[model samples]
Target: MFWASVGFVGCILISLGSNIVRKTVERILTAQVIIMWFILLICVFTLTSMNDWIKFFKSLVENFGKIPPDISWWTLASAVCFIGAGGISNIWYTFWIRDAGFGMGSLIGKIPGWRGKKTSIKLSGYLPKPTKENMRRVKSWISNLHKAFWLVFFLMNFLAISLFAVLSNVVLHRRNLVPSGFEIAVVQAEIFQSVAGRFGYFIFLFMIAMLLWGTQLSICEGIVRQLADTTYLVSRKVRKFVKRDIRKWYFYLFILFAVWGMVWIVLQEFFSELIKPDFFLFLSANIGLISQLISLVMLLYFQYFIARKYLPKRLWDIYKPHPIRTVILLLTACFWGYFVGMAWMEKLGLLS
Candidate 1:
């Protein structure tokens, strides 16, 4: 508990410090390059041969969508949502990309630090005029976005997950070892230790620590940005309070978030017995179901209705929505909707 609190505070400080400059977040993420490389190396070395990977992929294909009898359907659904930004947390990418200065996001400024020279910011952004030069720039931006999405997001995460799956099959599956809770990570480290001795174990531990630290920092920053944006848009009181100084609202909300997290941690530590493990599982499942359903509707509506209604016709030719993505979103929404209905029926003893 002590170590967890200390780690939490340290990551919060990193998030706070990142607000100092618009590019500080990028720099902090860049620093993780070494750790990420280490993780990749460890995972790659553990797998060792192509046969190991081929067998893993074969088993995955064989067991695709076959849920274990012991595991609840809700648990599987939530796990899917938790993996690879599957919930409304996927919206965090919007804020991150804006902060990265993509498209019109370059015009709308970032969250300012408490102690920095404030940058001029606007609540809204502009559409680039559909001149030939501007059209060319938009084309280039779209191209770059596609490349980055595939290379940085899809490929990296796909490889990482695949490697981890292979590691589990090679190391734990044969031994009939299934790790849960805090031991999930510790047991996984045996994969590395089997290959590289005691050093591998510590390196694996460090990699896990770094990954969790990065995840927490990004979540904190993203949620603060999201809440700040939502409040500023909806509440006249918040808009009046912040006036032009949006930084004040952002920092205040961040502080409140930090306080709430700390309070929750304290409660978890001192009154642990009162917080049933199943409560967390239930909460996560509901979050996944609710967010997945709501966000899918909003995404489809914005893509088909809002964009066409609001965007300039000239830009429309250049900013066409992907039909495949729209179809996938609808399918995913239907899936979660059905899952949620079934879960509720089960709880009501109707499904039995």
Candidate 2:
């Protein structure tokens, strides 16, 4: 608990320091993600046993229906729902990209908190009239955004999740060990120890700490940005409170969020016992599933209706998703929607 508290405080400090300088925050997160990938690579090569992989595959083929009785369907559903940022965290990408000065985001000013000089843009929400040159620029920006999405978001997450799946199956599952609560990090660290000795355990611990630190920092920064942006966009009266300085609003939100998190941590045991188990599971899985469903609808609507209608013909031709891609997106959405419906029915005692 002490170490967790220390790590949490360290993350909050990093976030507070870097909140003003977007580049610094980006660099810190990017560096930690890269380092984590390297650590995963080391563990894959040195720690995982080939025999365990064989057993894992064999079990999948021969005992596919044998899910552990202790693991509820909601647990599996929640894991699946989180695949490839299909949860609320998926929206954080938009926040990061906008603040990083992508597309129309370039026209809007950024919140320069404490570490950076304040910047102001003459045009707040307006975009310059679309000319052929502007259309071409927009197309280029969209293309670049696609590349970044695939490389940075999709591929990295795929590789990281795959590595952990392999580690779990080969190192932990083979021993009938399950990571629960505080044991999650410890179990993962043991994988390194098993292969490389006590030193590897320490290395893995450091890796875990660094990863958590980066994640918490990013979460804090992203949530504050989202809240401040939403508030500024939605309510004029609330907007007056910040005096048009998003930095001030962000800081206020960050402080509130920090206090809330600290209080939750301090009274976690009491809350844990007060909240029903099923209720927590329902929130974890269904809320994220609903968010993903909404995101998919908004994405499809933007692509098929808004973009197609507003974009220049040439630019639309260049940037529009291919028919196959659209079909795939629709299918994916439907698949998740089905699972979400089933989960909801089951939760409501309407389904067996």
Candidate 3:
């Protein structure tokens, strides 16, 4: 609970800080790097020796194909869902928090005194009353933090998503004795192939599409989009993002990304029935777990820095860390970090 609160405040601040000039450039460069790497990955995946690649896939299929499907599906679904929303929903989430409020102590202190205070962008009630100095410092720190974190955020995203996609695809393959690989493909290709096929899958997926566009998804996306874009709104280079999506291009980008997710589903369908499927499922679980651990670590670091800079001297004395609390924090960090690191090393085939 303590950590979660701290993390939330950190995310809100990072979202706010994106207003700085340097951070603006940093985030832009980071995006370009990710796009470049993905392009390179397309080339590599395309140019690789098919014969050798197929042979490797064949061996993987044979080995993992041994696992039972009952377990792998759960892991694969959760992992991809976790990492797939990384870069996109992350930005959206910031707005949700901002909308709620900032300056935790102030907010909490006010709650007991007032039963009916509400906040909005137009109202200014939700925002903390900013002093001249804090505003200047926050604006500066946030600018730098915005760029720094987003760069990390984007780059980490590439690593996280690549981990997720590959892991989930691999997990689905070796699920059973029944050749799910080609069978699933046939099922999908059937959807576009003929009438019965079209209704069988297309209608079903379309119905699923209704759910995709329904209230729950909308609420979730709303919160996430608002949060993620918060940083951009605060940044000096905010105009760049606005220019890119002037008619609110981000909303369109959100739709495009959602549709592209179908591509991931298709790829999984093609490979799900292969051998050694457990290999990928295990990877997915490990990756999701690791990603969460990274979130924990980053949030902690982000909060530590913010407290140092923002908290008042009197407030700091009141909130001073006790010796036992300090030890607990250190131990918790070490424990999660160790496990995630272990899983990562295992993924590289480095463990005994």
Candidate 4:
């Protein structure tokens, strides 16, 4: 049943991936209803259990600025990486910005749907002329983009994470119950029910399922687009073969990924003894770290090489990189790189 459920999600995600961005956005917006319910649930949970909140705060004070012994380096790195969009996830924002016709991204055409009459797009787009008016507009658009990301994306994400952390600390940590596996939902549901009755149990489960579905769909869409875009850009032969319909490549790659996942599931079932749970945990952690490192490198390369070299000098006044931001990124990249190397060493049994 567990495997079937996983497969079911994969099927739906691929189906969505094959569709237009609008369809995916519609589903995402639908799933966002869960967030409203979550807010309500948390408010009720807090109001009903003021003592729990008090205890949670006290515990936070007690353990302030100290890492627990059982907490691993891998855990810390994963948290740092994932507190916002981790790895190549933020790269997908570029795709979205282009599709939404932000700034110079307006010149690049979006990925068309399988059913659309607008089915072809240029692999490369024309550059906007370095006109003063265009530069001003571009700067304004970029400023709005920054505002949207920091104000909407970052703030909402921080709030959601804060709420969930409070809930977990108040409920699970207080009871010394660690959340793990499929049964984690059931355990969480029980906790919610204790505060808000039977309806809360069902609400919790529904919200969790919605959250997971949104995440799975997002991964499917982002990765398929990333792979298809990269292939079309990098390989002239691939571009020649596909002509201009990268949508087919996106759909095909999604199917391929789904098949790969199914095969892994089968292998896990067959080699259940050999493939221990810790192996999967470490595998996930390592993949996250590596992807984060890759993204960091790409970001630096873009800032230093691509943007600095390719962008018109006349436009540099309006769109130059911020020194403080660049410095912070470099420092964070170094910090994450160190932890990633340590994680790899520990995984390879090199750590004494």
Candidate 5:
């Protein structure tokens, strides 16, 4: 799912960001998602032995020490910042717009009376009448409880990331801080203890690497699309050109990212000698989470401000009961939150 999303997102926003790092990252995600999935699926269905997988992966590495790995906690923390700041705020904006509706005033009333004939004539069967069912669903879905869900989600992610970071640190180190790149290589080197184990480990990492790429792509492409959409909204005249060329740019961007990811992987395969078995997975997790958090925050913000303008009337689909709403949101929020938070707190001595 993550790979697919990344590929889709990359394809959407390849041309917008000019920064080398930004563009490279986006392209890397695109490539990784596509390639990694293909390889993983083949391995899974083929019933290949884990040992052989690990050994085969080791043979691919070259020079493998440039990037620093962080825990998922950091990313989760960042994501929390986005959702709290933007997501809920926009949700409020949506409800507010609905509540405002057409105004009521004596002078205005007179105008309505005066213009009633003209207004009637203008609106005459031109628009569909609003219905009650959707409104009910919307009312049911967006509630205080849902707000709590996002809140919990953020908090849980924080906890999960933090917890894992702490644990990884303790289990691997004496000073209680994450190890350096050399140290990580040393630890990861354990996979090489046997060819099969090494191969299996790479297979696993390859899968995750692809997922990370997807998450990254999901976020960046989102930015590109929103940017383009915002441009169109700001001025309809730009729509024809933006619409015509944007999709192609989007797909190419993903392809570019996927290639970068593969390049990195290829390099790693080239230099498997200097690396040790010990690596900080937490760091990688954190990097991925950074994008997730940004998306979450932006999602909330857009839903309220820019998106509301384009949303039309079908958005109010909040029909779940308060309990169900709370439970569902709570579960969704906490699951990811705790999962992410555990990684961070573990690093910082904030969790068990």
Candidate 6:
């Protein structure tokens, strides 16, 4: 709790002073990802015996149906909802890119706060005219963004999850041990310590701290930026009051969020007792699933109707989402929609 508080306060301070928080987050997170990858490789090579790997695969094949049981539908649903929530949050990439002054975001300007006048926001909706050169540049920028997303987000998540599963199977499952509550982290660390001893335990602790710190910092900044951008985009009165200085609004929202978070932290146990933990999880998952479904629909609408209508004909080939991609998006929405419906029914006591 002490370290968590320190990390949280440090993130808030860094966010207050830094206008280029996205770049800072990228650098730090990239380092964390590298470290995690190194640890994962080390564990796979040194910790996991060949017999463990074979037994892990064999267990999956033979006892997969017995795992987690059919009664854990809520847990499975929550996991799905979390993934959907994560997918929806990816929309924030556009906001971050714009803030980072990449491509057309460069023209929109950025909120300068303590970073100085050079980073000040300028109010404009100007987009570059579609010339072959500009189109090529835009395409290149988008391609690079996709590559970065896949390498950093997809690859890292895949490897981390894979490592966890492998480690859990090899270390805990063999002993019929299941980690619960506070024991979760302790058990997970055993994966590393089993191979590298005390040094591995220290490395695991460092990795957790770095991951949480980076996540908190990025989330704090991103939420502030998104809230400020949305407010400015939606309300003329608010926009006039803030003028081109989005940093003012960002700071205001930051304080508001901080205060609210502190209140929640203080009252968390009270709230937890008032609303059973399972019910709270259900409520959160329901909201997240609904939001995710809505965002997915909106994304498709923008891609198909808005972009096709407003975007230049010449740039259509470069900007248009492929048919396969659109179908996949729709399918994902449908999948989440079904689960959300089931979750709601379960909440209403109509489904079990």
Candidate 5 clashes: the total is 89
Model 3 misses residue 183 by how many Å? 16
Q: Per-residue CA lDDT of candidate 6, range 170-226, in tens?
A: 767777988765576677687668768988888776776666676666667667778
Residues 1-352, model 4: lDDT tens digits: 3644484466545454545664555456555645755655664465437776576678778988676667666666566666666766877877877777787666667776565444555666766678878777878997998898896568877666756777767667778999776778789789888877988788777777766666656666678778888887788887678766776676677778777666666777788898665566556656876787778778788767887788778775567768897887788788779878876676578887
Highest lDDT, which number? 1
* Most TM-score-accurate candidate: 1
- Residue-wise C-alpha lDDT for candidate 1, range 1-352, written one tens digit per residue: 6765676687556656755534665677667756776776767776557888778788889998776888765666666666665667778777767767898888887766766555545766799998999999998888888887788677877777787677667677877999877787898787678778888888878877777776666667777878987787677788777775667887788778877777777888888899754567576766767877998898788867988888888787778767887787788888788777766666667876
For residue 241, model 6's alpha carbon misses the true position, in angstroms, by 3.7
Ranking by lDDT: 1, 2, 6, 4, 3, 5
Candidate 2 has a TM-score of 0.85
C-alpha lDDT of residue 270 in model 5 = 66
- What 10-residue stretch in candidate 2 is worst by lDDT? 119-128
Give a tens-digit lDDT track for model 5, residues 1-352: 3444455445444433332223344356557646765654443434334554454446335423222254444544444434332322323332222222321111111101111221110111122224677455445445544564565445644443443333233334533445565455344334322333666557645655565455555454444434433343455455354343433333344456556555554555566565322232335445445445455556555655665555454542232234564455445455546545665676678865
Residue pairs with clashing backbones, model 1: none
- Give the range where candidate 1 is weakest over 10 consecutive residues by summed lDDT: 14-23
**Candidate 5 CA-lDDT value:** 0.43
Clashes of 3: 31
User: Global lDDT for candidate 1?
Assistant: 0.74
lDDT of 3 by residue, 1-352 (tens): 2332343333333323343212332354455445545543443353334554465567667876353445433344344334534322444435433433433323421110011222112212233335566556555544654575566665666664543334234323333323352354344334323434444445434433332233224333454355324533465354354452312333343444444444444555577666244555466556555555566567556546765467665444434445675676577557545655655655566765
| lDDT on C-alpha atoms for all candidate structures | 0.74, 0.73, 0.43, 0.70, 0.43, 0.71
Of models 1 and 5, which has the larger TM-score?
1
Which of 3 and 4 is ahead in TM-score? 4
